[model samples]
Structure formats: C-alpha cells, structure tokens
Target: MFTLNSQSSVGHNRARTMPTSSAPRLLFLCFTLLSHFHSSVATPRHLRLSVQDIATVEAAQPARHRAKAKTTFFEVDRPLHPPRGSSGPCSTLLLSHSFALTLTKPPVTTAYSPPSCLRGAGDVSLAVLEWRADCHGVQYDRIFGVWLGGAELLRGSTAEPRPGGVTWSVHKDVTKYTSLLATGNSTLAVYLGNLIDDTYNGIYYANLTLHLYFHRKAQSAPTPAASAPADLIVPVSRSQPLDDGLWFVVQNGTDVESTRVTVPANAYRAVLEVYVSSHYSDEFWYMNTPDQNGPFREVTVQLDGDVVGAVWPFPVIYTGGINPLIWRPITSIGSFNLPTYDIELTPFLGKLLDNKEHEVGFAVTNAQNSWYVNANLHLWLDPKASTTAGGLISHDAPKLAGGINSHSLDGIDGEYRATASRNISATGWVSSSRGNITTTFAQRLNFANTNVVSKNGSEQTINQTIDAHTEVGGGGAYAHQLHHSFPLYIFLGGNGSGTSSQRLMRKVQIGFVESRSGAVAGTSTLRNEQVAEAVVVLRDDQVAGASWRMHQVYNYGASNGACYVRNVTSVGYDVLFDHDEASCGGTARR
Candidate 1:
C-alpha cells in the first residue's frame, strides 16, 4: 500500500511546528533514558491458480510430481553449523505434519516425546529445528512463532504468497534448548495467524521437525565453555496463553510489557534473550518525521524498577515492506528468521535469589502504534551449592545523549538530522560453588540518522547507521565480546507529473555486520549486504507497469574452518545469476 499521503501530512505538520528563524541549526531534544541500557529459488513459469485449485492439483498429483512442481523461495544465508565429523547417531521427531493454520483455528499443539533411542541418553550434542511451509493465492506476510514448554524457540515471518504458490524452509540451531527438549511430555505449539476472506484466501500449510544429534565417544573437537547451554530455561512471557504467541503489544513509549519470574536458588548466571517486531504506524520508523519524535527508538530492559540494559534494534524490513514487487524471490536479510538480542542479567541475580518473585519488564522509548515484545530467561545453576548469594556492586546508566534537529523546512520540503549515544556498565560478586566470583558487564551504542524531503514530499531519502559493542568478563570465565553495525539507505520518489501519469521509483541499500568472540562459541563473523531498485507506473492507484532488480551478497566464517559465501542477482521474478563459494577470505574487510 502507498503511504505518500500520510508521509506528506506528517512533513507538513513538522514544518509548521518549526521556528520561523532562518538559522540552519534548530535542535529538538527529547531524550528519556529510563531504559537500562538498554531468498530465492525456483522456476520461471507464471501460472494463475486459486488456493483450492492449487491444493487439489497437488493432492491429485503423484508425490514425485508434486515435489518437482513445487518451487522454494529462500534468503541466502549460512546453514546451521552442527558438530563436525560423524554426529554419532541422530533421531528425527515430527512436531507437526502438514498442519493447516488460519485465523479462526487455535495453534497446533502436540506432546513432545524423546526418541526411544535417546530415552535416557545424556550425550545429546545438538538439536536442530526444521520448518517448511507452502502457500498459494494472494496473502499478506504474517508473523509466526514456535514454542516448547511455553518458552519460545523460533520466531519468524511467512512469505507473501503468489498465484503460482511458493514453498520455503528454515533450519535453526536449537542446541541451546537441549534441556527443554529433553523433558518428557512437554507441549510443543506452533502459531501462524492468517486470514481467509474474499480477497485474501491463502492458507498456510506447515510441517515442523526436530533433529537431535548425539556426541561420538571420540570427538574431533571439544565444545567451548561459553557455548554451554543454560541448565534451566524460564519463559518471561504471559502465562496461561499457550494458544497464541505470548508476546505483549506496546502502543506507545509509556507502555511496559513485563512478567514476574523467580529463579532457582542455586542459579549463578542469568541472561535475557529478547524478540521484537514493529507493525502499523511504526513499520517505517526510520522515515518518521523528526518533529514527531524523529526516527529514534530503543528497547529498554528493567529489573524491578531499575533499568538494567537497552537494545537499539536492527531495522528489519518485512517481505511486504515498501514495494512488495522487489521482494518476490529474495526477501530482506532478517525477514525469514528475525535475529534476537541478548542482555546479560547476571549482575541482577543477587536480587532474584531470595526465593521470591521479581519483575522483569520491557518498554520502547519512543514507540508508537504497535510493537510486539517478549523474552526468555536462561539461568545456569551451581551444582555444588543449594543456594547462592550475591550483590550488585555498581550500576552506571545515564540518560540518552543527542536528539533531533531541524536544519531547514519549507512546505513539506525539509531536512532533519538525529543522533544518540549511550553507555552502560554493571558489576557484581556472587558466592557460589566456585567461590566468590566477580562479574562485570559493559555496553556502548551510537546512532545517527538523516532524513531529506524535497519536491513537495514526492522525493524522500533516509540515511541511518547504528554501531554497538558489548563485553562480559571476570569470574574466571572466558571474556565474551560482541560487535555489530547496521547501515541503511533508502530513496523513494516519484515523477513530478500528474497522478494519472505518475511514475514511482524506490532504491534501497542495507547491511548487517556482526562479530562475536570468546566463550565456548569461539570466534565468528557475518556480513550480509543487499542493494535493490524498483520502478512502477501507477494510474489512479492501479499498477500499469512495474520492474525491479536486486543483488545480494552474504559471507560467514568461524574459527572452526566453517566458511560460506553466496551472491545472487534477480530481475522481476527471474534469477539471473546465482553463485556459491566456500571461501571466507577478505570477508572481514567488507
């Protein structure tokens, strides 16, 4: 859907609110730091078929024929890195088999049972989850999540379907949830909210499988200590709601989504894993008018009433974002599998070890309309102590620095700039089985954004960048360090002709770079870049002609000699060129 009208109105109002002076620098600071912290594949044929017709055809065809006809669309990314060498013996468990998901139906729920071969096996080394889905007809992109024992294991978005139908699969490394999967009679749930109406009639058919790999007696390499999974996993989410996602919706900056949790008395380490997505008014938060709070938003984590950490989220564009035509075969970087953030909560474990319930909350600093948020608490237990004691020694978190400034504005044509930075640190000591261990956590984040609106709002451009670093050390544990950066540039404009003969154009360049080291996970680096452009001829809001082109390059490497590189280019729905390599050389320089 085109949103030029809303954007133009927002720009006009922002200009009216600006000072009449001719100065080039007009600062508008609104910083409240309460927070802690804080794919393509497939064929070239074009066929028009209804949802039911496609399903009937598939049912009537032979299994081999159906497999040959189905086309899979996916994002280019590295595959899950399981233990090298022979992974001992492996067993596959079916979580769901071709389950139909719709708006009126409840989530698919099934009881999980450990494979008979691993009924009492304790050498399970890795667990991987595979999800596959197919849809036809016309439908909007929808969000979905998978949960085991009420703890979320995967959160993703469905691809928008076409008339010819599309199929895709996602493979995720779930080794961190080994403890949860081992529990007997645990409930497994999958939820995908879809609509079936006159205009949109696509129904999502999904299948989920879990693979468990046991470690061989003689291993080629040892698992890192930092890679050790949590002993006890806790859900920091809504209780009694196993039918749908436990995510909480926040409408504004004042809205707080929180849950009370009580950790085990013997727990010595804690970390919160958060998942978030924006929708409705905040979908294009990067282009929001500067006078209307600008385009800066942060997610804050709070322990009880104190801010513990904060997260400046990566602007993940969904499949249907902007012009949907550009994402036909190749979707955005995080469109299929949204990335999750980790916040070290070990510093606040002392306050939670009193055998009492404490609140863990999340909020968006400048949120608007709607945003879904949830988290999981991972706790490590001390085997030698039935109970542990610790205290928070120091916590230094200040308000956000920098804010929005209006450089120039004239009748919906103006320039706006925004910048912000934050630093947070915390230290604590715990007396556990390993003696008195002291731990410290530190994080730094920087952000910059510029928005230019010209030609009476017909021409709009945005440039934004975010850099962040985090570290955790002490307690004789290997130091953990993580660095990441997100750079985005977008240009949306239209020919200054009349509405009937107008031509709209859009260009986008986005990158996601991340590196992690120390701990058991070893060292790893990932770089993903995408450049896309689209042009459409619209007459009275009806598309008359359209064309799109996209190019993407992905590179990933690890200290264990695991390297993967892929480059792909596409025009419209046809893949022009696709290449794959196993070399990671020179990836760090990009």
Candidate 2:
C-alpha cells in the first residue's frame, strides 16, 4: 500500500524499525447506437496515435528559454544506449541505458497563469536527475518519481553507487507547480523502486533534465523602481482541492487520518504539507518499527491537536569494504533525501482561512503503531484587507491521562529493567489582523531499558534509552519559532557461544524562528541538526549461525540555516513542534 512517487517531494524495506514500507487503461468509444437502417449507410471512425503515443505527444512540449542554450535529452526519438563496459564514474549513458518520456508542457512563459500565489515567486525552472554508479549489485535507495497531468511532480532519494563512475544527482524546483504548470499537458512518468527484481543484480543508471531558467520578464521597470516600501498586495482566493496535493494512510491502532480544508475565498496566507511515512509502520508485527535487530527511529508530528515537527532520520551506514549498492534494496536505510515532516501552518492560518469548513487532522504518537501520511493545504488571501477571521482563541490538549506507562524490573543472580512514558500538551490561539496568534506547545517522553539473560543459556546484554522534548509557537500573519531535541542510546551484546556486539543511535536538534508584521514584515532563522552513530564490535572464531568479528564505526551529520529581516524596524516571531522519542529495547540475539 505504498505507491507514492507520482511526483511530490520537498522530500523503504527495512529490518530495523518496522511499521510501513500499481496500471493501465485507455479505450475511447462514441457509439453509433443501433440506427442500422436509413440514418447511416456508412460509418467509419479513425483515430490512430501510437509510436509510443506519438513520442508521448512530442515529449509533452513547453520547456523553452533558448537564446542559445543546449544540453537536451528527455527524449530524442527514443531507443538509446551506448557504453556497457562500465568504466570509472560510470556514465556513457550509464553502462548502457533505458529511455522513456512524456510530460506535456510545464516550463511556462507566454503568459502562463493558474498559480494564484500561495507562495511561488520565480518559476526560475530547474529539473535534474542524473545517475552513473552501476553499484554492482545495488540494494534499495533508488526511488525517483516525477509525474504530471495525472498528479505528483517530483519526489526524492536516488543516486547511491560510487564505485568510481560517480554521478548521482537529484534536484527539482520546477517552480513549485505553477498551478500544475500554467495550462495543460502533463503525462510524464518515471519510477524506479527498490527491493530489486534482480535485473542483472545491483543495477541502476540514469539521466533526465530540464533547466530553462526563463528570464524575459524584466523589461518594463528597468531603473525607476527604488521607492523603498510596499507590502500590501492582497487578492487571493483558493479552495477546491487546491490542485490535488493530499494523500493519506495510517495503520493499526484504529487508523486515524481525516481531511477538510476550506478557509479560502479570501484567506490571508497558509501552507501545509506535513508528509509522514514511517515507511508504513516499519514493516509489521503490526506497527512501531525499526529494530530489525535494534535502534533507529525518531519522529513527531500532530496537527489539529497541534505539536508540528520533530525528526531524526538518516541511518544509512554500511562500511564493510565493498558495497553491493546498499546490500540489496531494503528501505535504502534512511535519508537519501526522501525526507518529510515539514510544517508551516501560519499559526493556524489566521484562524484557519475564515471562509469556513476546517478540520485538517493528523496524528503519530507511539500508541498502536502504524503510520503513512501525506497532508497538503496551501493558501493565501486578504479578503479585501484581511480582518482575520476566527477559531481556536483558547484551547489545551492534555489527555493521555491513561496510556503507555509500562514497568518491569528484577534482580537476583542477574539484573533487569524496562520503563516507558509519553507526555503531551497542546496550547492555543487564533485571531490575527494584528496580534493574538498565540500558539504554545509542550512535550516530554522518556523510555529506559537494561537486560541480562543467562541461567545456563550463556550470554546477552541490552541497554536502550530515549528522551524527547518539543516546543512550538506562533503569533499572527508571520512569526514562528520551534525547538526540538532528541536523545537516544542503544547497545547490543551476544552469546550462546556466538560473538558480536553493536551500538546504534539517532539524534536531532532543531531551532527555528520567523518574523513578520505588516507590509511583508521580515526576520527568518533556522538551525537544523541531525546525527547518526553506529559502532560494531565482534571477536569471531569464524562459523556459528554466521561468523562474527565486528569492528565497524560510522557517524552521520546534517545542518540547515535561514534568514530574513523585512518589517522595517519592528519585531516578530513564530514556532511549531511535534514529538516522538522514548523507546526502550529488548530483542537482538542471533
């Protein structure tokens, strides 16, 4: 139940933290219903279009801006391949190749219209997808989707092979969907899934491009526009599935994921795309995944109940010398850039757009375990000067009153323990045209563990821990701030005569701030950090379920930054946060 990749990203197989991890049709008929007699002595219909549908309608047109630019290849009459010797850095069409394209128009201009500005400034076009590391017998991490006229326009996570042929890129800015590309044509498709089907084993190679960067709109205001102030351009009206950008799925624990956003028709600004996918519950025993053997998983996001964002994903480490792609397509491990959990709900969007009908909900705690979500809601308006409507002027969510607080501990000739906790709090506000956008949040989670098993069975030791915290805030048209911290620890030891020990951890630290107050007020800040650590220790004597002699180590890193300061001489701010962290452990013996 995970077919995503029709095109949508701004961001699976696995043994580690399991929870969650399809075509055809065209037939036209305009019948000539039983008139068999005098009304028709001859009726013949002709409509032929194939040659791969006429080269996918001439490659879906519209990708211009050529005052003299060249580097084309989305298609040139198909049939392409050259270079199977697979040399260094790989590309020669990538040790041989495959080709197909069809995306009817989307590099706009010629006065294209449709995107009523939920926030899209420069259609400064860009599209790149290149791969050239044949990674011998690849495994997972190859999932690229770009579709059109049928939905989805860009996804992530690709480019891994680096045995010398280098060339693994993935960039997209296609003007964030210029209203699905101004006007018409969009049947372009490309999909490369993982869990390989042994296509000659560990295989993947690619190339795709679209870099227009149109620049012809600078002709009428040449040099007379330096006046210094202007931030009141209001005239927005969005509502009507807003051009399809919503997807949903939640498993086990009574699956909960609802939708109904309609506060447009003169709104004053809104943006939501909180994509969630614990790869579908990590992969089953029904939910709460990522512990094939142990360690990896930190996510937090809950809206309608508020808590906005907290993430720590990216545990892709395999430093055992050779690399058969990633050991064979399992869930590509983590963060190749297929990342999500993004939030910016404009402090509840001026009381949720004011036009009415609202209830865009989402949830992902540790209870019942099962998640796979995609939430989209983007809008912007002023209703002839935005007086800011109403909703949630006062609220508080703190009802876990009874759930998840398990306990266990004992000591005799051996010692042991296990504990858990899930804290929650949601604050509130709504009423903006000038202050009262208050939204405060709080979160706390703690889980601990220690174990030992051996009465004559030999050896084993496990230690696990996680502590999480979240803080979020919002106040009016523009002002947000978020603080997040994730802590984790895991250690695994073995023995029934076998030898091996491992340690894995995932961490996060986030700090964000945004400011605005009338006339496009300004002040933006960002600090995002991520870390992954792995330690393997083994002293094998060869042969036993599997030889063990571990001595491996890896560390991961990530960073982010942002800035803005425009409301002239004033102050503004905002914040949002969600949480999930606090997992103890027990389950790792080979």
Candidate 3:
C-alpha cells in the first residue's frame, strides 16, 4: 500500500497582512528556510538584503496599470549549459518535424537512425534533447510524453495559449540513454492528448532535435569492473501505439496499471524510472478537502503483488491553474518540465532474472481520477557471467503513521491540518563476476499540509511541505544518495461583494531544492525559488486594473566545476532586473 510521511507541528497560524513593500517579508522567510541547508557553504552576499535596500526597492515600485492580455509567453528558466570548450564539434539530428497534436489523432510515430557523422565517433561527451512548440487560440494545458524505442525519454506539459499565440521550448540532458540511442534502427513516438472543439480551438505544433557532442580526444573504453548505467532499457508501457498515450490511466485509489516483462539471466542491477501526472479533480491535490485520506497521495510501485516503493510527487501548478493572470509569463516550477522519480530495484533482481515473466505495477493511494502512470526498467547485465544469483536479505516498509484534524464552524469555512511519514529499507546480495555485491536501499519521506478557508469560502490559504531522503549503497561504497525538499504556499482571496467591480488577489511562494552525492553520478546541488503576488480588478468578467510582482532565483553547482546562477524580478510584464553568472564567483548584483 502507498503511504505518506512528514514532520511538523499541526495548527492554523493566523494570516499576516500582505506586505506592500518591494522586498516582501515572505521572501525573507523563504530565504531563511533555504539558508539552513547552506550553513556549511558561503551564501552569495547579494542574496542577503538589508533594511535600506528593502526601503529603496519599495520606493521604486511601479504604478498599477490596466491588466491586458499579452500575445507572447515565456519563463525565466535558464537555458541548458553549452558543451565544454574541450569537447569537439557536435552533431545535430532532427528527430521529429512539425507534428500536430490533438485528441482525435494517435501518437506521432517515426523511425530513428543515428546520424552518419556519429557512427565512427570515438565517444560522446554529452547528449541533449530540445523540444519546441507553439500554439494559439483558447485551450487548457495538456500533458505530453516522448518515447524512443518504447522507453519514455521526456514528460512535460503545454502552456495555456492566448488569442494571438505562444511559443516555448525545453532542453534536457539525456546522456544516460546513450546505449538506447546507439541502436541500429528504433521507433520514436510523441503523444500529446488534447481536445479541439468550437470553444477550445487550440492545437499544438511541435518539433524535436537531438545534439551529440563528441570528445575532443579519443577516450579509453569503459571499464567493466565498476557499477555503471544499465545495459538494457525495458519499457513498462503499452506495446503498440493504438491510443493517444502509452501510459495507463488510474481513476481511483484501488486501480492498478501494470505490465509484464522478463529480464536477462545475467542481470545484476535494476532501477525503475516513473513518470506520473494527476488531472481532472486531482490536479490541485495539495489543496483538496481533508477527509479519511488526509489530503495526501502517494504513487506506489509494485513487484508482482507486493509494494516495493512509492513517489510523493511535487505540487506542480500549470499556467491555467488558479488565476491565469498570476502566471501570464512566469509559469510555475516543474510546469514545463515535470520531474521524474527513481526507485532502486536491485534488491528484486533475483526474482526478475528467473527467465519468466513478472508483473510490475503502479497505483496511487487515495487517488481520485485521471492519473497517467508508466515506467522504464533499466537492467545492468554482468559482463563476464552468464547467470547471476541473489537473494533478498531483509525488507521493512511500515504503513503511514499520521492523521488529520478538522475544525469548522460551517462546512465551507474551516481549517484542516494533516501530517504523515514513512520509513523504508531493503537489503540483498548478488553473486556476479565482480564478486558478491551487497546492495542496500533506504528512504525516509515526510509531508505536512494546512488549509484554511474563510469569508464564506471567498478566501483560502494552503501551506504544504514535503521532505524526502534516499540512499543506495553497494558493498561498502555509496552508489547514489539524494535529498529533496518541496515547499509551497498559496493564498487566494477576492474583495467587494459583487462580481463586477471586484478585485482578486493571489500570493504564491513555491520552491524546490535538491542535493545529490555518490560514486555513480558525482555531487551536485540545485535550488529554484519563485515568489509572486498579483491583484486583478474585474469589470464584467474582464480584467480592468491589474498589478503583479514576481521574483525568482535559480542556483546550481556540480563537482565538475559547473555553476549557473540567475536572479530575475519583474513587475507588470516589465522586467526590473535580470542577473546571470556562469562562474562561482562572489555574489550577484542588482
């Protein structure tokens, strides 16, 4: 069964008055929480603000303007890092041309062949995939996925379009799929499930390409002794493109989407990568009404009939989520590029290598409707052994431990607090050519959410946070370790009694932090924080006067001497300042 876990006190904190200054007090609070993780490191001086600076910023606030729709849309996310100077020339291949997507059409399928220039290349230093799309007219945000040889490579969502048009692009690092790309001839599929009608007339047109950067100097062959990427990728999805998507849909908590597969007898290591998205009534799951389910959900992974792992997804708000005015040009984190979860499956390799088909399943605990779920099983084959033997040493996964407290004067106006947590661990040993390798996996997850509604349901506030830590070890060496934190806060309210001459206000502060270290992938840290506040006046269901402020900071650093820091502030569709730095120097500047 799926479970939830979290740590925090439960209670409703009185709402504070929204700050009127440019330097929002909520931004300071968010920075305070982020500072705890950088205690051992030096935080950029510019990131710290003083009273005088706050006053200066407040004094420079621009005057409110009549809110009007815009034709163009974009985000402040930084572009992908370019190839290093040492890396030689790069080759680009067009994977898909202009492809139109709609609910009446099936997945766009095509054959993929490696570029002739890369056939004799010594080695690839890096590989990147880029997707560009454009749309116009009215439509709701839609989810899409890309697959190569049946293995899902990317999962993302489209931006809500305006009357004129909107265009956006996403770039992703795909070096992990080097083996898959080297295949002789493989089928590539792109699916975007969308509807087109008289009211919703938007259609998505997309293009995709792949770039491979070759190593400047010939590199030595990879050694077979150390733990490396999987040798085979098996898709746990539909076999043929008979529908709009290869993923299975789960409508309720008990629904399970599964697939059967067989692995090679020589496999010694395995990992499952999952992609999930909630839609319909569950799209805003974080703020759902609290009940027996406690306003928390978990995507569970099953081996045969037993639960093995679970994913506590982040709350990603699409462009059309809540009030569209708040996200005009600044989409929420994880909105364009949805995050994927990984589950270490080495402990179950023994059962998967029996030369027989086994079932791999997915389900969402306390789910409502319209959740698309699928996975890819990556298996590492022994280089010198024809068959491998292993056995499960121990397994322990307790059910979630927590509950919800609801206090309400009326059903529509009340406060709800929920908390949950889970601790899981497993150990196993495999005998291969490299020797008897023991693998251990452990995970600790926690979640907490508080919802408050008042003024006869005209106002609502939600504060939620999730913390997760995972570790995978082989023998005495750590293979991988990751720590992630998700913090989200939202306040929605309306002023005036009537629909006309009323004003709507929204305040949101969302952030994601990730730190990873181990032998397999190296060490890296990334943090992205966004804060936005907007007020829109409505006259006859149309925007009249409007004002908004958005501030975002993205910081990333890797052991390979890669660093990217960018900070942006915008007001009323006009960017106040944008600061970018490629080096890990001192602090940023305004």
Candidate 4:
C-alpha cells in the first residue's frame, strides 16, 4: 500500500496575499486510505491532486503559478542526459527496443543494488499505474500510456486553502475534480517533496495503472460516408503498385511482388486493416494501435520460400527491400487437442523497391473460435545479423535453408497431431542502370522443408529446414528465442559463436528442452532461450519548451506477451505495454 505525509512548511513563512485555489485535505486522506485498501487486489493508490492542491502548495507561499494562466504545478524536469545516442541508420526491423530513463532529481546510478526480494511479487508489489482527471472508459497497462494531452504527478495536499472556504480533502474520492476539468478550469497544487517509503515512492518497480473515462461531447449526426484522406496503407501483395509520392492503393493478388529494400532507410511497417463498428453512435471510426491488427501473415515477397520477409504489423508496408519473417505455431496438448498444420512461405523473388498491393487468401478450420488463432503470417523488417555467427558469404541470400527447428508440447500426449507448411519460390529479372537485364536464380532451400508438425493433436513440432535449391535474391536469416514455462534455462553455443554468418540470423530461438517432475501431481521445470537485437528510438520534434517527449517501440521480432498502462492524463489516454500480445482475444486487445 502507498501513503503520503505532508505538513506545514518548516521555515518561517512570510505572509503573502494572492488569489489562490483551496487545498484538498479530504481527497488526500481518501487516497491514502485507498492505497492501503487496494494492497490486496489492486495496486497502491495513485495520488491525483486537484487544481486547488496546486494553488495551495507552498514552499512558503500559497502558489507559484497563480499569475501565470497556462502553467502546471508539476515541474517536468529535463532528462539528466539527452536520449540522443550515436545516430546510425534508422531501422525498420522487428527487434527488441529499450524504453528506459535516467532520473535527475536524486541522481540515479546504473550500478544500484539489485532488489533482494522479487519485485512486483510480494507485499510490496510494483504496478504501472495511470489516472486521468478528465476522461473515462480507457484501458491502460504498464509500459505504454495513451493520453492525448498533458499529464502530471499528483502530490500530497497543501496546508492552506485558496479564496473562500474552499478546502481540499484527501483520503477521499475526488469525484468533484472531474466536473472541474469538464468545465475547462482546474489546477493541481501538489506539495512536491521527497517520496517516502510507506508511500509508493522509491519503489524501484511497480505496476502502472490508469484512471480514465470517456465522455463524448455532442456533435452533428454521423454521415454514412465520412470520407477523410487516409494515411494508413495496408499492402495486399508484393507486386501491387503503390504511389511514388506517398499515398496509393496496393492490390492483393495471387502473385506477391518482389522488391529489394535497400539498407539504411526510414520507413514505417504497418498493415491496412478493416474494422466493423460496434455501436452506431460511436465517435471514433477506426483504430491505430501498435499492438493489434492483422489477418494475413508469414508472407515473404521472394522468389523462393526459404528467403522470407517478416512484417511487424499485419499487411505491413514495405518502405524498403529488406523484410524478415517472425512466425511460429504454438501447440497445446489436452482433452481438446486441435489439428496441426505446416505453412512454408519464406522464399520469394520480386522487383526492387516495388510498391504494390495484392490480396492473399487465408483459411481457418474454426472461424469463431479459432479462425485467426494467430493464423496470419508473421512479417519482419530490417532484420539484423546475429553477432555470434562467424561470417557468411553475403548479406543478400537468394536460396536459403533452415535446420534444427524446435517444438513445444503440453498434456504429456503426442495424441492429436497436426502439421502446416507454406512455401514460395524466389526467381526474378533484374535491370541495372549500367548493364543488361539479368535473371538471377540461386539454388536455395524451397519452402517445402520448413514445417510445423504435431502428432494426434498432442506433441507440437516446428520445422525451419529450407531446401538448397530454393531461389532467393536479397534476403538474410535471423534467429531469436521467446519465453515458455517455468524453471527457465537458456543454452548458448560454445564460445557464443554457434550461429552462421553467411546465413546469419538474429538469435531469437528459445526451444523448451527438458521437463523435471516432482512429487506434487505435476511439478516441472522448463527451459527456453534465444538471442536477438533490441532497439531504442529517440524522437526529437522540437516544440517550444525545455522538455521533449520520447516515443519508444520495443519489437521482440516475435510474439511474446501483452502490455498496458494503468493511468490517464487530464485528457484521455491509456498507457499499456506487453510482449507476444496476439490480435483481438489475447491480452490488451492483441
């Protein structure tokens, strides 16, 4: 549980007169109480101050921003060190990214002692929390907070009150504050000070939550066709054409387009999607999420299936030629075992830097229950080579082959077996500025060898074998691992140089190896591991202030988990973050 402690200023106060807002003692008290109450089921209380609190917060005076009309009470200090690192080529790859910060007020150190106790696990748990004073009906999770406007930190209440008998209350529900925000006039006077231990301060880890609401303002009746120029483009196939100067439609067809995504380019990998309205009167018509949206996947615009391109977002756009694949079937064995299938869609051949769209077909045995079951192909961009791999023949691969793919199992049964495979060959005609048209075909592995097989719907199998004869031109390989069950142990190749450089792949493969059972009905220990690249993006869109906002995107190169934020801003925004979150039914809207 979280608590707050604030008292009148210690120093001698020089009496000063000024127009001010009242302090909220009742509300602050209520927050303290809620923090303790929510300890069991929910997280500690997120102290949200009202405008009155801001007005009354005094180091010695009533408020500082009294005369200033558009200033906030919370001081948004700049980062100790600017986030700008060595500016290399902006990547459109599906690699892990970091969203970390260095605190300035107290001067945090990188070598701080690791917590002795498991964080966010025991009595003192950590949760990413969020609270919005203005809106409602927004869902937030840790890692990502979605708010449109400014956000603030709510400190404890002030000692004095502003004009009239308007006293602020703590340890109570500040429901009245919402009304003040709706009316467009509200201030928060937080008695900013060092956070205490009893309170949520100094806790290295905590869950982030959100307090949000959505109250729609009345507007004109909706038109059947509310047409506005759309910036979002979903690609259908590799060959469909896209406009050179920004916007255009790419048709989905039987033949996927072949193109070379030259290295070192700034591009966005996104998908074109369709959403059905849930309510007729709903205001927002479409959704733009970094998490959910896709029905087609595992699509490599190559001549051969072995050379695959993975798109991050479903129907991801190809801003360049390089695209990688990040897809694997997860199998569960039990009374309700499902069929297994194989789809080898890695290798491909196409035009260089071509912009086109074409629709591909998708099928699912069960639509309502399992239609999308992550059936869509996995797409990747700007896949980096593994450092461990010694060295390879070339970065661009025409024909590729895969080997030693792993499989996951459940229920101690190889009963319900299934295997799915998809492959596309790569073959292309190339034309150069200083040469004749050349047709390139390298004997690489075809997609037929890669397979996902399970037996009797029980034991699950994943295959990554590519034939040597598959024709691929410009694609490289990457490998990475993901998390599975408990008792985790990862294996590193001898001397950490076990991967191949010529066919270099990102180390993203974590296969479950062995299981140790105990006396307790089914106690067990599992292991999984993979190595891959993690990215960190620092954006700079200079506004008229000392402080700047940073947007971080952490792509794991594969599905792992889901994420969300718990708090909201004065405006409406839900913050959330997670790994391997699937589309729709998975955690946090997938």
TM for candidate 3 is 0.83
Off by over 4 Å in 4: 1-414, 420-422, 434-471, 474-590
| Residue runs of model 3 more than 4 Å from their true location after superposition | 1-79, 82-101, 120-122, 219-228, 291-294, 476-478, 540-542, 586-590
What is candidate 4's local distance difference test score?
Answer: 0.19
- Please give the lDDT score at residue 307 for candidate 2: 48
The local distance difference test score of model 1 is 0.72
Residue range 180-292, candidate 2, lDDT tens digits: 44443323344444333432134555554433232234332221111111112111111223211223434433344665546654444444544444432232111111112
Which one wins by TM-score: 2 or 4? Answer: 2
lDDT of 3 by residue, 238-264 (tens): 767455567777767777889899999
Error of 2 at 535 (Å): 17
Q: What is the C-alpha RMSD of each candidate to the true structure, in Å?
A: 8.7, 26.8, 11.8, 27.8
Better of 2 and 4 by lDDT: 2
Who wins the TM-score comparison?
Answer: 1
Reference-based lDDT, each prediction: 0.72, 0.31, 0.69, 0.19
Candidate 1, residue 520: Cα displacement in angstroms equals 4.3
In Å, residue 174's CA in model 3 sits off its true spot by 0.8
TM-score of 2: 0.29
